[model samples]
Target: MLLNPLLSLSRSPSVLQRPSSLLRPLSSSNLPPIQGGSSSPSLYCRSLVQRLDHDAFLTSYFWPAGRKKDAFFALRAFNIELASIQETVSNPAIGRMRLQFWRDAVRDLSNGLPPPLHPIPLLLSQTTTPSTRDLTAYYLNQIIDAREANLLDPPPPTLTSLLTTLSTTSTPLHLLSLSLLTPTPPAYITSSVQHLSLSIGLTNLLRALPFHLSRRRAVGLPLDLCAKERVVMEKVFRIASGKEGGEGGLSQVKGLREVVWEVAVRANDELMTARRELELEGGTGFPVGKEFMPVFLSAIPARSYLQRLEQLDGDAFDPSLQRRHWRVPLDVWLAWRRGRF
Candidate 1:
């Protein structure tokens, strides 16, 4: 992972030039603009989720019609809203203001009313009805908090730190989805979802390597690992940003492939761990996986992604990896049939 160095937004000339409207408080008079054109809030949220995050959209697409599927769309849309703030702004302070608006919106949702115009927060507010079970304010806030951390520009400085950050985002979404299936979650089910969430989240981040490299602020590889592997961040960024110098740019990044392989290996380890945890706990007590397939369905795509990355020799910036239409649904359906993901 090669990321841009941190820009000193506080003292930077650009921050002063950024519009004051970008930092205004969120209220009826000052609410930030939201992407609102669908026929209904649910339609808006579902389309936004599908359009922005196809991988996650597929997870909910297979789910049978139920309140749980609705919850998945609301949650996924909320994630996109927060994740896109940075992309939508020119300055870090502006991005933070957008995130703060979400935080305030979450606060408003807790008060039994979200902004009337926005779809994500309003849909999220609906998910908190008395019957929604363990989908609590705490879990939603955890996801928001994690996104808030990344709002600063550049990602967590190391792989270990990065996992810590992702655990908040992915783990909460997975656990909350499982919780929607039942009010009182089993211990093993909880543990397995947590592990699987990290696995899926890490894989999701790894797959976005190219996109991140092209961004102004690129996430750097873990310093110690880079030092040990003799990986060069500059070369990694150049190849990743498609400025590959035309001389096998991926190969140019000394030991970057090894770092990516280690990440893949760890993801594989977590996949196995999740399966083991589910079997050990759910197998002995109840048929958790069979009953709650959609909650765990994300793991299938995550696994399929790992398999594809392996084929590319663990090169995160492989040209083929960037190609759209990777038969993701078929892979997920196959994994679904195996009762594994």
Candidate 2:
């Protein structure tokens, strides 16, 4: 499966687009008009199916037209919804409970029984087949594992430890899932997804660092290294955001932002390097020249957004940094419409 050349193309930036006003809270006018009939099993199932279709519509650009595209998107959307529950829930206990619910749902699906009435399970049922069922179970188990691991805020003793945790927590499931689904998943897919996931995850982590740092400070944890990483990360963010100056800003933060930037840069380079290596190996399903545009475009804006966060925060790390960096870039929208990198 790795021999397929088409899979070699980099994911385009266009794959990230959604309607600009979609993020706004639903209002009465925006809400669907109410109907008089009671919601039935068919109605519920149809609604869930529509959601799956909507998810495919939103992300189909990342995938070429094929059965794989349809099946993968359906499974991916379900995974995204399940994963979001854990991240969005404020209480760790509640998050764990939701994770367990998903775990059980996976088992039920695997047993040739339909999943429970939850939207995710309902959606999964529409796409379920014997071969895909195990894949779904594997993906859900990985999410559950990640959730369990995240319940505690353990400080890594070394950089290796941090990377090890990230690989185990964040990388494997997606890679394995795509690998299983695609007739042959190009090496670029794994490399790209890993790089993209790490970049986004780390960006989110950096945004939350201020809160973590404050908590650490209160308890008097030796945070010199953490502080330095934050400084480095901020520098990377600034560079990404098109801010003035370069590494010179590194000194201003006492190295906190420098540390963070170093982490992000290293992570990005690792992914890019892996991609290069994959491209060297007979080059997968599609030629890079044709496929790379979308991938590069999507990635640039995401990288820029992280950099923007650094600028918005200036020299200091702010707890609410994410909110400040939430706006989608114009390039991202353009890429989405173009549907190619």
Model 1 misplacement above 4 A:
1-39, 131-135, 155-157, 239-246, 282-288, 324-326
lDDT of each residue in 1-341, candidate 1, tens digit only:
31211111112221111101011111222222334543366777776664555566666656667656666788777777776676677777787777778777777766665455677766676666755523466787888787677666654557788678768878887887777667677788788888898788777767766556665355535566677798777777776677767476664478877877887787788878887787674454323455576777777667777888898888777655654334556656655566656
List runs of model 2 lying over 4 Å from the truth: 1-94, 176-181, 188-192, 208-224, 227-254, 284-301, 306-341
TM-score top scorer: 1
Local accuracy of candidate 2 as per-residue lDDT tens digits, 1-341: 53322222222212222111111111223222322212233344333323322222233344444444444444554545554564356677887787777778878988888668665465555556676677666766776686567554455655566656556544554454454345355666656656654554444355444433323311111145556444344343454344746554433545554566655565556445545644555655223332333333334334554566556544334323323222333444445555332
What is the model-wide C-alpha lDDT for candidate 1?
0.65
Residue 295's lDDT within candidate 2 is 36
TM-scores for all predictions: 0.81, 0.59
lDDT of each: 0.65, 0.47
